[model samples]
Every structure is written in C-alpha cells, then in structure tokens.
Target chain A: MEASTSRLERDYRRVLRLLPAGYRRQWGDDMVGALLDAEQSAAAASAADEGPERQAEERDIALLQRPPLREVAGVAALAVRLHLASPSTAGATAAARLRGDAVRRVALVGLLAAAGPALLSAVTGLYWPVPPELEALGHTRVDALASALLALVAVAAFALFVTGRHRTASVLAVFAVVPDLRHPLETLASAWRVSPGTLLGAACWLLVLLAPLVALLAWRSDAPRPSRRWLLALPVVAALGWVPWLLWRATGALVAPDAAGSLALGAAACAVVALRRSDASWMRTAAVLAAVGGLGSLGQLSLLGYPPGLERDLGWTALGTVLLAAAVGVVAGVTGRRWSAQAAPTAVTAPDRSASDASA
Target chain B: MALTEPAVLVLTALVGETRHGYALIAGVEELSEGRTRLSVGTLYGLLDRLSSEGLIALDREERHQGRTRRYYRLTDDGAAALEAEAQRLAHLARAASARLRTARAV
Candidate 1:
C-alpha cells in the first residue's frame, strides 16, 4: 500500500511541472507531499476492510492510473487562485502595490496616445507613399504626407517626455521609431556602422529602439516617489560629452582594420554604463535592447562583403533571426513578470470571502 | 443561462447541499458521469471566481471524517441561472432532434 502511494506521488509530481514557475516555486513541494500523505492514509484506512494487503494495493493502483488532463488543469488553476489570495504568500510592499496601480493606468494612456498618429495616417490615406513612377501621383501624395504624421508623433513624444508624462512619452518614443523596423538593416548600417546580418547589430537595434518603451510600460505607476536612480541620467548626459571626440577619432582611423568594430564596442560600453545608473525598470529595458542590437550588429557584420567561397549568408540570416526572437521573448517574459508582481498585492489584500463563509 | 460548463457543474453539485473543495470536485465528476473532473487548482480558481461573482457563497468549514473541508452553497441567483441554462440546452436538443427526424424522412 505504501509503495503504491509512493508511486502515485511520483506521477503527480511529474504533472505539477506543467504549472507556471512562480506557482511551482511556492507550493510545488508542499502540495506533492500533502497529496502523497492523503493517499497513504486513505490506503491504510481501507486496508482493514480488504482480505489482504494486496487488495489495498490494488485499490491504490487503480487510483494511481492517470487522472484526466482536465482534472489536473482544474487543480492547477485552483492552486494558483489559492496562492494568490493567501496573504502570507503575496508578500508585497505597500509602495509596490500603489506604484503598480499607477503604472497600469499610465501604460494604458500611453498605449492609447501612441496609436494616434498611426490611426490618423490610416484614416486620412495621407501617409502611404506610392512608387515615384506611378501614373496617378495623387494617391502617392498620401505617402509623402506620412512624414508629417510621423513628425507629429515625434513632437508629441518629446512633449510628453518634457511634461513628465513618462509612460506616454515612452510609448510615443516607440511609435516614433517603429517605422524604422521596416528597414532595420539600413537603419543599423547608417547609424551604427553595423551590418544587418550580424547578431551584434540586431542586439543593438533592439536595445536602443525597442527596450525603452517596454521598460517605461513596466515602470511602477504609483511609486510614491520618483526612483532615486534617475540621478544616473546625469552621468549619461556627461558620457555624451565624449561622443564628438570619439567620432572624430573614428573618422581619422576609418582605414584601420577594426575601426568600425572599435566604435561598436565603445557604444556598447557607454550603453552599459548608462543602464547601470538608471532606474531598475529602465536598466532592464535598456539592457535587453542593447543586447539585441549588439548581437544583430555582429550578425550583420559577419555577412557583409564576404568572399564568394568563404561566406555563408543563409547561416548569418538564421542566426540574426534567432537572436531577434530570443530578445523578443526576453522582453515578453519581463513584461509578464512585471504584471504578476503588480497583481500580487491586490490579490492578497482582497478578502477571501469563500474561506470565511465556509468556516461560518 | 450563459453559465460556463464548470459553473454549471458546480451549481449542480451544490443543488441539494453544500460541500467543501474536494467533495465538490468529486460530486461534479459523479454528476457528470465522470465526464468532467476538475484539478485542485482549477476547482479553486473557479470557486474563487464564482464566489466573487456572488453565484456561490462559502457555507462553513469543519473537520469531517478527519479531513478539513470548506463547504459552499449556491446563491438564489446561481440556482436560477443554472435552471435557465438547463432549460435552454434542453430546448436546443429537442429542436435538433426534430430537424434530424425530418431530414431522415426526406
């Protein structure tokens, strides 16, 4: 009987891994132990009515047969709810709770505001450029008008930033830059001297272009005070002081074997320093973008000007795509973690009327 | 009349009396002819959602047969909703069967 219980416990443990990491982290082991104990006790109680211990073993065996997947899913869901509502498990600071609410509201507003230009351009048919040689240039006029729309988005973003509407500012910043994704390779080549086929360039683009919006959205909305780490922006401002000199040096050494490479390395180092001094939310956002951009740059470089026999262009493309996918996944994971953290405090503080009513 | 499958099963199980977490799950399975069984997590998640919506209220907690159980009862609204849903389903089934018989005759 004990052996059968042990076997059932083992099977159940394997199924528990299907749960989310956070849920498993808090309750996985304890739940497994409790279920196993319950099974063993049930077996023991039924053992007396059976003719032999083998009959009790048979009953335990029947119970151990695979439970339906639906049952398991249901149990997992209940576990998550119980854990969420359990005050002892939530462990959220008051500041974090308030900040979380503020962040959600701010993020929603930013997302809505950022959609403005894109929505307007789509509606007015003014932003979609047509080929220059097209017979009917009137339709193409809309495409040319798109630049004005983009400019408006950029201006709105800058205004938001200046006015301390950071969330909306960040969203606008992203909206302003999204058109660049259409020609990511060209953008990298022109701005950073990195090829689109290389991992480093891709990483750089992601870090510099995509991460800030994600970070701003993730920032706690109701944090009682501004992050002290905002002070780090001063250092970033100072680092820009050396950009002109570095640019001059690079121009002089353009003929050097690794001059472009050195520039990439230097930019990455500066980004790291800037990130370290920023708020925790921004730091993570910047780090992810930088990492993606840097990798992309490298991938692009590896594919450029390759000798016919020596170069593998497809391999480089695959590498760049994988790196981009990974960076996106990392950003998504970070977003999810932020949301769960925000939700935790609310779940904990809310009354567990079900439990209380059951007791009464 | 728009109750989800899980909610319907839960209310059905609680039609006559209140039952705690494990018992409610077992009762649901039995009532469904073992077609619907809920895991602990899913059961609790639904329970929380149902309780929050005021469809089901927690009744009491006590040690029964050496195991602690939390009992729940269907609220008046919940019972009414369940009955309406059942009626709707029955009406649909009857209409479908009549259509099938007509088609068979043709």
Candidate 2:
C-alpha cells in the first residue's frame, strides 16, 4: 500500500508538470495535498462500498497506481485556462517576465493570424498585383527570402506554440513580423491618396502587422503550454488551411472559385471534432487561425481590386472569407463555453463517466 | 452573480468557518450529497476565481504532518452570494411544491 501510494503521488507530480512553472510554484503544494486527500477519500469510500474481506484485499488495487486519463485531460485543460488567465511571473526579472509574457501571447496570436494566408501566398505566389507604382517593387530575391522566412517562422512558431515552447514561439513570431511592419506602416501613411477600398485594406494589413506587438504588451505572464498531442494533426490542419486556396488556383484561378461553402463546411467539421474533445483548445486555435488567415487574404483581395474581370470571384472570396470567419467564431465560442461547463462537475464524477462515455 | 456548482459548494463550505483544501473537498461532498466530487484541479480553479472575485479569502496557512494547509474563509461578498443562491433555490422548491399541491387538488 505504501509503495502503491508513493507511485500514485509520483504520477500526480508528473501530471502537475503540464502547468506553468509560476502556477506550480504558487499552488503546487496545495494541489498535491488536495489530490492526496481526494485519493484517500476515494479509497475509503470504495472500501466501504465493498465486502470486508474483498475490501482488505482490493483496497490497494482500487486506488489506481496510474493517474486516470480523463482526470489528466481535465487537468491539462485547467492548465491551459490558468495559463491564459493567470499572470504569474517566470522570468529572471519582474519586468522581463511581464514583457516576455506579454510579447509571447501577442506574437502567438499574431503568428496564428498570419500563418495560413502566409502559407497560401507562399505556395501560390498569390500576391495582389497592385498598381503600377506598387508593381515597380517587383519580385526580388530579397522579397522571396522575406516571404520564405515569414512562412517558415509562422509555421515554426505555431509548431513551437503547440509543442509547449512558449517563449521561443513568441520570439520567432516577433522576428517574423518585425521586418514586414515597415511596409504596412508606409502603406498606411499614404491612406489619403489611395482608394477607399485600398485604404481599408492597408488599415487591416497594418493591424495584422501590428498585432504581435500589441499581444506582446497585452499578456502579463504565464502563457499557456497545453499538451503537445494537440499538434499531432498539424499537417492535416495546415493542409486544410491552404488546400482550398490551392484547389481554387488550380481549377478556377480566373474566377477565384467559391470556397465559402467549403470553408463553412470545414469550420462545421472542426466544430464537430471540437465538440467531441473535452478541451478542444487545439480545435479552437486552428479555427481562429483559419478565420484570421482568410481575413488576411480578403484584405489582399481588396488591395488587388477585382483581379481583371473576375468580379464574381472577388465577391465569392469575400463572402467565403466572412462566412468562414464567422463560422469559426460562432463554433469556437459555443464549443468553448460548453466545454467549460462540462469541465466543472464532470471532473468530479469522471471515473464513472469515462466508463459510461468512453468518447469523453 | 450566479455561481457554478463548484463555486457554490466552495462558498457553502467556507460560509461559517475556515477550511483548508482537504477539508473543503470533504465539505463539498457533504454539501452536494456526494453527487459531486471536485478534483483538486477543479477546486483550485474555483478558488482562484472566487478569490479574484472577492468572494473568498485566505484565512491562514499551517504546516501539518509535513503538508502545507492553507485555510480559506468566505468573505462578505461570498456570504451574500450564497444567501442569494439559497433564496433562489428555496423559491424554486416552494413553487414546485405549490404546483404539486394544486395538481393534487385538481
């Protein structure tokens, strides 16, 4: 029994590692004490519910030596919530930690926002053929390198974020965006001379360019580090983000063919998957990134105008952009709130629930 | 404000006296008739929220048998919240009873 108890305790400690360092520092002991108390209570209750001779023999076995999977999943979800919600510092200096947390949060979000469109642009060279003035900047090696870096850094940053490298992801995201900031700013400065549509598009681009900096300042500390299993489906998701654009380019480049219905369908599919997941953080993030990326492309479309005579293509693209973005928002919000509600009481009765609802 | 089931149980546990994490776990089980069992992770999340909302406060900390036990108590805001919830539930119970009585008469 002593050996078994110690093993259980060790398992709990490993599970605790999913949480941020600062959170662990502050509440780790209390958390351990509560878990042990719960284990003890559960063991006693199970023993009382069983026959005496059987109880004496089975008490040790009843309390699992391994941490239950659902419990661990719930705790993982809590870790994400705490990471997003808690502002505990974990850097060498107070200011640095705050700054680091702030920058990382923004850069992460900015990274997500930029990633999909950036990938699509890189894959298809789907640059908006701007006015003759803008076209003068032509495709140069420097431009290609910047695009490559942007795409690589965004994916790497997202991969890092999903894999629990908080600061490194942030640094990568900031590094990716800083070089491109000047162009958006310069574009925005000429707002007075540009068309209204172009001005709106530039403003949106400026926001996209500036988001990471804002995110950097906005986050306090204790950014989220959810489970790495969240990234297991990254390739599929990355494909989903770009494949539609690819299909459009290949099949109907002149028309910018309708991906809106497909985008909505994809969002609905993501929502279905997310609904099945108790945490669904990964799904939510993926949906948000997809939506933001679509918006980015829409902004580019505005800058590109009607693309010769493809008025319908621009209209369809714009519609898909709005609907997909809205679909992600609606689905993410509903799923997030529902999961949050499920996280509470369900965590307590998890063992029984897991046996009944294996999908949970 | 409407509190979640765990938040309500936590407030009920801390309504009269201070209790530490282990004790609160026991208190909540008792309060909820054993239908709800809060995991440690859930408890702390609730505590974090309740504390930030000024509904609960840390009373003190103590070392017992090599374990640190930090005691928490319900604040005035917590007591008020609990009372309101109690009234709401009581009102619900009363209405159900009255409807049942009318149905019996019918």
- For residue B84, give model 1's deviation from the true position in Å: 1.8
Worst 10 residues of 1 chain A by lDDT: A253-262
- Model 2, TM vs. native: 0.45
In candidate 1, which residue ranges exceed 4 Å CA deviation? A1-55, A59-351, A355-360, B64-67
lDDT per residue for candidate 2 within A10-96, as digits (tens), equals 788889887767667667677777776667667666777677766655545544567667558757756655444434421122323
TM-score of each: 0.42, 0.45
Off by over 4 Å in 2: A1-5, A49-64, A86-360
lDDT of 2 by residue, B14-89 (tens): 8789899889989999999998877777777677667756677777888754667788888777788899998998
Q: Which candidate is the best by lDDT?
A: 2
**Residue-level lDDT tens digits of model 1 in A1-360:** 134445465677677766545445544454454344444444554666666676568656645656446546655544333322222222223333334433333332233323333344333345345555652645456455666667567546644554457667666677787776656555555655644344354545454444335535344222233443433332343344345447547653212111112223333333344345433333233334334343534544454465543244433433444454345445435553564465453333323545433323
User: In model 1, what lDDT does residue B57 have?
Assistant: 81
lDDT of 1 by residue, B1-106 (tens): 2778888999899997987666776678788887886666566556656776667886776654343455689877677778899998899999999999999999
